[model samples]
Target: MTAGNNGTNPPEGDDPFGYLYRSENGAPSAQGQQANSPRRSYNEVRAVGDRRYGQQQRPQPDQSPSPYYAAPETQPGGGQGGSGGPGRRAAGRANQEPARRNGLLIGALAVVGAVILGVGAAFAFSDSDDDKAGADPGASESADAGQDDAPDPDDGPPEEDEERPLPQENGSSLRLENGPVVAGDVEGSRAKDGSYIHGFKEGSAALWQPEIEEDGEYTVFVGYTVPGKDMSLQVSANDASPYSARFSNYAGAEEGDWAKGWTQTFAWVELKKGTNDIRIACGDKAEQCSVAMDRIWLEKGHVKK
Candidate 1:
């Protein structure tokens, strides 16, 4: 028999014992022996199988266009959307942000500097105030010195006593009698002539031994009384010149009868200390008037500067 006869093809009835071959239809069958067949890798087999079975491979995430991706809409400029638009605007704002931040920082620094300056100025002013608040020792010392040198109001020298008229022997010193009449047992009578008129009907008239060596302001006080009339007292020095105003007397009215005494005072009378005639009178009517004279006191002193 030849290589392939019925018997040699023999057991074609049962499937090959060791290995089985499947057709493209996945049916197990024994067929003609393949010779010099092209070998396929696993990936190539998968590709061919996918092509033959009309199956599609899913696209890789990285390889496919994303569903979220949007086509860029843009202006004519190639900047952002398609090329240049909003991207350029955002880039410009980003560039300017640093400048703005720098400006803010600089402004903050300026404010801090101003605050420091203000604090320094306040400290300087406070120092000046503190200086002013302290008392000046030099000024206090000067005031103390001045006070030490100043005169004491209460402990000063006593005022000098005024010189008084001297009492003399003889009636040459005329005594004031009733009214303007000068009457003394030793001295001759002298007339007042109403030279010094006061409001009284009675006054005093006297003559003093003048001492020209003692030239000073003299004050003479004559006290007297009159009856029934409002009276004032007056005195005159030297000759009785009607125009000579070296006379002074009490200012207001007098009280009491001639028997009762009324007293008055005369102010300053410029006089020489030599023999000078002094007359006292009443300011009543000359026709019928009289005054009772009392004591005559004289004082000599310097004029106030």
Candidate 2:
């Protein structure tokens, strides 16, 4: 048989390395040929051994996946096309610089994008706040006005009503000469209804009986006519010393006009309660009253005139 058909030959003894070229039955190879088969090459056997060893080896979890180059002196070179020399270290440094630069660039881009997004968010928030405030501007002002109009809790109590002045009280009134005759030269006038008392000669006197209830200050007023020179009168209460005084009027024109009436307020006087005696008489002066007295009464807050 030809050398190409040698698979049909018998086995050679004492050939330990000959098993790859010829099996026991001399079967054809997977390429469908029984032609000349040599032992596997050194490179092929080594490649196969490396694959099997790699499968059995454990992976290091801390190994950096992308550090593509490293110096053999520090760490074995892991980059592409690395020669088994110090040139591997130079190539490793060159490739590492570019990788670091790329990493920084990516980080810078991420920061810039974050800044841009933050600025946009800030602007959006500010615009939303402005819109809300502008939606009802006058509402805030009205609320302020309402607060101003509200009454203050600190204000004091309401003012009390003012007290009014007391009303004036009056005592009884009587014709002057109609007072009980008390040792005087006073005479009844011919005037109508005992309207007057006349002839108050010097030292002449008459009295008034007042129905008083308490001992207090009172006012005495007299209505009279003086047509001659000013006439003076002595007024007394209970015949007391300091309780007596003289009152005079200058309302005279002449003796012929003695009938014209006038009124004079005699000063405040004090009276003992109940049925007090009040006297009026011509003055100590010899030429004292020819004056006529008409009405007499008592009131408060008056003075002799």
Candidate 3:
């Protein structure tokens, strides 16, 4: 029978493992020195892991190039013109892929940021346009500011009414009840004839029948004078309850000096929308009645105009 050799042939030497016991065969020991001969070394220097079974032996750095292997300058992917090797080219490609992806990501982010900024600017511009369009351009801010600066109704007097003359009657036109007329005597009398009624010690009174425009509250002003003393006068409108009007010594004059003591006082009264009867008198409930009366007037509101 023939033995199977496959593609390899067996060794035909007397002993293939003889190198393991070469010292017993009179071979030269590495440490022993021979007569007149140089010493031999058994240790050889080569690159670590350069030789392996069924693998090509890598050349040492100090050795010249072998005829079986090509030089680094002539091999593919070895020189500067080509990538260093398959492993190095793959590593370089992997590294370049990350850089490229990062660059693309940065560009995408920049685009998104620009889009967002543009959208925000557009919204801002649109809002500004809408505000301008909705607002009244021709209107003045003074109107709104005036509203804020306006006086509160309860805080102060109301705005002055129009120039329409209020319904009023002077002393000369009014009818006298028990008081006597003093004409052209006292100074600062607003009556056309400068006539005034006075001397209402107990039942003295001045009466008026003035026509009113509407039924509302009215302030009846009496132009009078006191000689350095205060007094309280009685006034009534439309025969309603009487009101006590204060008469102050506004002129600061001496006693019996009715010429220099000229001032006015008022009282609140209600009247109907027609002819209304008004009266001022010094009756039983009167305080000091020694006063010089001059003119009479009416305002529409409870405030003094």
Question: Cα lDDT of all candidates, in order?
Answer: 0.47, 0.55, 0.72
Q: Model 2, 71-129: lDDT tens per residue?
A: 43344443434465557767778889999999999999999999999999999998888
Q: Quote the lDDT for 230 in model 2.
A: 66
Clashes of 1: 20
Segments in model 2 whose C-alpha atoms lie over 4 Å from true places: 1-194, 242-252, 301-305
Q: Could you estimate the TM-score for every candidate?
A: 0.28, 0.35, 0.44
Best candidate (score: lDDT): 3
Candidate 3, clashing residue pairs? none
* Pairs in clash, predicted candidate 2: 184-205, 227-254
lDDT of 3 by residue, 43-134 (tens): 55646665332234566888876635655655555553345666667778888999999999999999999999999999999889768666
User: Against the true structure, what is every candidate's RMSD?
Assistant: 17.1, 18.2, 16.6
Candidate 1 residue runs with Cα over 4 Å from true position = 1-206, 210-213, 232-234, 239-256, 281-284, 287-289, 302-305
> Candidate 3 regions off by >4 Å?
1-164, 285-287
Q: What's the C-alpha lDDT at position 86 in model 2?
A: 51
Q: What C-alpha root-mean-square deviation, in Å, does candidate 3 show against the real structure?
A: 16.6
